[model samples]
Target chain A: MREDASISINEIQEQIIREMARLDDWMEKYEYLIDLGRDLPPMETALRRDEYSIAGCQSQVWLMPRMRDGRMNYVADSDAKITRGIIALVLRVLNNQPPRDIAAAELYFLDRTGLRSNLSPSRANGLAAIVKQMKAAAAARMNT
Target chain B: MVFTGTTYKKINTAQVLDVDKVRKDFPILARRVNGRPLIYLDNAATCQKPRAVVKRIVDFYTRNNSNIHRGVHALSERASGEFEAARETVRQFLNARSTREIVFTQGTTDAINLVADSFGADFLSKGDEIIVSGMEHHSNVLPWQRICARRQAALKVLPCEHNGRLRVEDLDRLITENTKLIALVYVSNVLGVRNPVEEVIRRARARGVPVLLDGAQAVAHFEVDVRALDCDFFAFSGHKLYADTGIGVLYGKEQWLRILPPYRTGGGMVQSVGPERVRYAGLPLKFEAGTMHVAGALSLEEAIHYLRKLGFDSVRAHQRRLMDYAEGRLRALDGVTVYASPSRRYGAVSFTIDGVHPYDAGLILDKLGIAVRSGTHCAEPLMRKYGVGGMVRASFALYNTRDEVDALIEGIRRVQELCGECKSTRSLQ
Candidate 1:
């Protein structure tokens, strides 16, 4: 997926929508999300410090960011598997994208895929916060 | 169709309250959640209102809707009569000496704050000490903390054991001559462990320290005789007692109520207001200033009647059985840790599962139409003591059945599957 850094944000969202459409119901969608979470890379023990942690969510999520080849890279993990899976989805679309592109992308697919409404309020807030964190990181790199 | 699993016995619902029949009284119980029947396990947060309580609220608004204590019209007189009647009901319910001891406040927190502010201002001073237990909800702890900070009084904690049960022996050692008051929860909201109230009260009395029992959790499930316990103050919320929100009682000893300054002063609380000075009303009215929760008080009377009619012995027995059954089933689940293995818990149970965050488990349970509370349950100190981020709590009531516990077990197992192992072969590079 990193090889396709040139992929447009809209194209990535379309791919996500098509993938979500394959699921018939909420249970299936939840199961799929859990599986995605299960597949998330285990965060390093050293990186799981308070500095990297996001505070507002019901569950603890740790995100590590890096800049390489003029693209923003985010590696995230959650104590909750479903939440980790949601982070995985966010990473899939946003990672390896140029800072400017990542900062400006609307990511309307969250609403279009019904993930925003389907999730619990705290989780939904967490999702939005993660996006903001990503955008803030991008916006910071732009300022530099 | 009897549902039974290994080490889980089938409960005879007839032996207890007929949960199905009781369930019908609550209209909210019939509603569907995510295409499944609703299973309410968060009774400690707030129990669902029964038809009797709801009808009383509607009836109050329909017929006797008017300001209490001051109006000259028929509606006012009737409303005032009914409101005082509700106070009498609360007095009887707690076995208080008189209705004069019962003061209406917004809720348990409000009631506790009333005592803290009024009592602390008068009795406390620099270097005075107040003793609280570790298992108290933020509501119980904060008011005392505020008072202590204001008066320069030291706040002491009677710490709980690793199992979340406070040791009464610790109280004796913690209480010194500087100890002016002892405030504690009658039952912990998070762990469902009933505190050693008798032992706590005895120690406090020996020291001549006034005690306040936060009965917000215990009132619905346990029989609390304020006269028997002889606590200086008892506070509880009506919402947790199956009545409407915004109504609660502060049962203070008559002597204490008389001595403490008026917490808040306004229209109803004053007897005669002169430009130079104002005289406060007696007993309860001094605390219950302004227009009250007229409808809420009436509905609370209905809730009290409903409980008394059902009887406490049966209710306690039913809930004890439910708690036992719930703990046993939860313990049987693999990789599950059930907290507060106290010998006598009435209705609440807290647990955590390995490899699953409590929030994740709670979310999954919600999707399955089971409502369990997750997070610290407003007892962050208790959580810190246990060394856990949070827990999944399922508390019971008279309406909760064995079937709900079974559903909870099944839901947990499903959560374990959803959260446990990853089938995907992808690896972090």
Candidate 2:
């Protein structure tokens, strides 16, 4: 592991812990998750929508990002109501986090939110793929 | 123009889709969904109708809509002619022995249930076993499950091999003298993996066990000749193959259809009615009960012509190129993990990104005018097997292109930042 990257990795971990602790209920936490998705910078109109859609999602979303300081910085939006809420939750914890840390981000918050437990097996799957994609982007940043 | 991030080259999507011509064919594709252009990726559920199919339905209802066989009215004769002609077209489609062997039903699900209730209910017994594959859609899987349960028989599943293909070794292990049936999907709706149904059926036949191929996905993307494959039964939905939704085909061997009892007993199927027992007509009529979806069948013929014009081989090849482009570009991106290995499968890819949910991924893609499917894809068992609760599946038909793929790739990257990391995988081989 690169010595300098470790410091940033820990920073993300520390923030996630702090954020999780501060929130009292899943409802509050979900709001926080939405906030995370909201933090994702807006992608340019051209890159936001086209053909990059994953099938079986009930909503339309556009995602784009840039590499900054060797970490992934994302911009995303969604047309559907609930999906945008879900995206915000994902962005809150992972944005600006390094690849290794992002890859390693735990699902305890999801467990606490009861989102994982309640999602139809399919919805849970979509969650996993999105999380996997983010870590992959971070890993690519590290590799690059 | 297709949307793109600043980092990627912008794609002018207008050049990709012949907007006016193509959009005209599909009336629904032109409509807006959630205040955006309706980018349809729900073809696996059921495809939208082309003008040919829509027009056929309109003509049938407007001019000659009537019941088949018994009707003597002018409208009845015309409708009956059109309906029988539709059956002949289906025979050619499957290359069946004759139109008599082809039975119409509500859909693929109904077709399989009809076979299960008829052939399975009669020949299969308490000790018999039924074999299905890991890649079967729920429609193919459940009927066998219920039939086996009712008969006190065992239901065996062929395991999925690495890269999502069915293991023939497992098929062999599952086959035995008491094994009466093997039902499987020719191509998976989720993983887009192709199964070697011919080889599997050949082995099953060697053991004297019959096989049923669910051709719902296969009918659209590939050519099928049931005679050459020599499978005992083949079932598929017309909608998936470009026809109307209510119609589907259940093709059986002439001898099998003759022996198996009718699934539903009603008005048109019986030759002579008696208080004690009603005598049923032969073959196709025995299986077809009630007033059938005549106009839907007629529209299906038009759907077949649409496919003929595009040429299925060419369509599959075109889809492959797009799948290759999608597989390469998305899998190369950070945080993308593809579910299937690159092979000569149908045009579909299931994947996960590290930070974002599949639902979230879909919503973002939708906002960008790119539509996709997310969730278990109606294969909860398969989902459990994959160890992912669900996935994002991007499937394609004839009209998709390289630009759409590229746009998807770049869009995923942006979506990634919102989630934290994107971990899409490329096919290793």
Candidate 3:
């Protein structure tokens, strides 16, 4: 978890949008996202249980959450590269944030950057499922 | 493009029907998508409706739109007549013994559930086995699973080869005294392989077990005769046959329809509901509860008529040519791997490319105005068997053209070029 950094979800979302906007084409943007996925930290094999998996995703995605210093820290991975990329974008906004902030945060960067509409129905569904699982994990930790 | 030689002619033996004329029937085919001409190769999902079917639906809504079988009004009588006439069309389409055997449901899924629920409730008992192929779609498998769970019956799978062909030779060992029914897919939507349903049916008949064939993919391209097949039950959806989405047909033998209870008991399915006791309506009507999709049934009849006009011989020939072209194109691609080289395959052609996800391939194809189906295709078990996450499937119909197949090839090449860097140079083996 990056304890030194504390940026609002909106600011992080804008940063992502700005980075994505630098790319001229959809292919370039997708390639950048795939690279981000490749560079993202791999989830621990021990944490990859079925309970942590998100349903309704076209790809098999696992999300494991941990409470580190009152903030929700998540580790995620997916079988498909594009899905992994989408999940990486999702994790960037919500990871290492306070449980309440994570749960309440409306991650609108995907829609603002035109990623949501440009995505195929199943891809959009996979992204939504990942977001839902992340929020649910945050909410669960908050409750506990 | 040189389609010369007897081999080509032998493959498409049916007289060359005017494809350009057939293409004109579908208005949507002329339109463009994503700045490119729309090349629809997703026929396995649902076929595009011709002008005839569309005009029939519009005409029904404009003139004779009324609830069937209840009212005394002229519109109701006309609608009732049309709906029953549609039933007769389906009866003739499948060459069923009688109209009394045909029951309309929401679609193939609904039809399968009707049989699985009603038949399982009536006949299935504890420890009884319902045999289904591994290649069966979730629709055919899930309903039976639910019913088996409820009735303490076991749902046994008839295993298929890695290429998705079921081994009917193992039928002797698989079917036991406890086996009640054998359910199979007449044509696999994924592999596009026509299963040895006749052999399976003969085997089941020997064991005195009734067989149910999911003919959702078969009815459009092949000549489906329920009487000739002698299968106990056959189910298919209208949408895949170029008809409306919400309409489907379930054809059961009279003996079984009489023996099995009603799937859903309601107003239309009752003889007389008195205070003391109620008697169910006979045969087909007993299965069709409440208000049916009257307009959909009529439109389905039009779709059937359109298909009949084209004739199955030309339709089959056209489909075979498309599949052959598609298979050849896919096999020629460096990274592309075609799945299930079944002997008697038609219509659908599924493949995977190195270092590209099926969804990614499908997305790129969509951008190029080539629509194809990606992912498990409702056959998750088959995916698991093949050890692939998902596959991109480009299916054909009578309406699909050689030019469209060329566009699909170009689209795939574009996908490869775009995602080339991301692809690992590792061996697939």
What residue runs in model 3 are displaced by over 4 Å at the alpha carbon?
A1-7, A67-72, A96-104, A118-125, A136-144, B1-14, B421-429
lDDT of 1 by residue, A4-118 (tens): 6488777888988888888776656677888887767889989988878876436777887778888898878877767777888889898988888888998888888887763
RMSD of each: 3.7, 14.4, 4.1
Better of 2 and 3 by lDDT: 3
Q: What DockQ class does candidate 2 belong to? A: incorrect
Native-referenced Cα lDDT, model 1: 0.86
Give per-residue CA lDDT, model 2, range B1-429, as digits (tens): 232321123253212323234446777777775466666665666777888888889988888877888879888888888899999999998999899999999888999999998977798899898888877778887888888889998988888865886788776777888888888888899988878888898888888888888888888777899999999899999988778888999999988888898999997899999899889988799888899998889988888877776555555655665667677786787777888683665757889887666766775666566788877787877888877756888887665555667667766875675455322221112
- TM-score of every model? 0.92, 0.73, 0.91
Best by DockQ: 1
TM-score ranking, best first: 1, 3, 2
lDDT of 3 at B12: 29
User: Residue B26 lDDT in model 1?
Assistant: 92
The complex in candidate 1 yields a DockQ of 0.43
Error of model 3, residue B125, in angstroms: 1.4
Query: Native-contact fraction for each model?
Result: 0.56, 0.12, 0.16
- Candidate lDDT (C-alpha), each: 0.86, 0.73, 0.84
Interface RMSD of each: 4.0, 11.9, 6.1
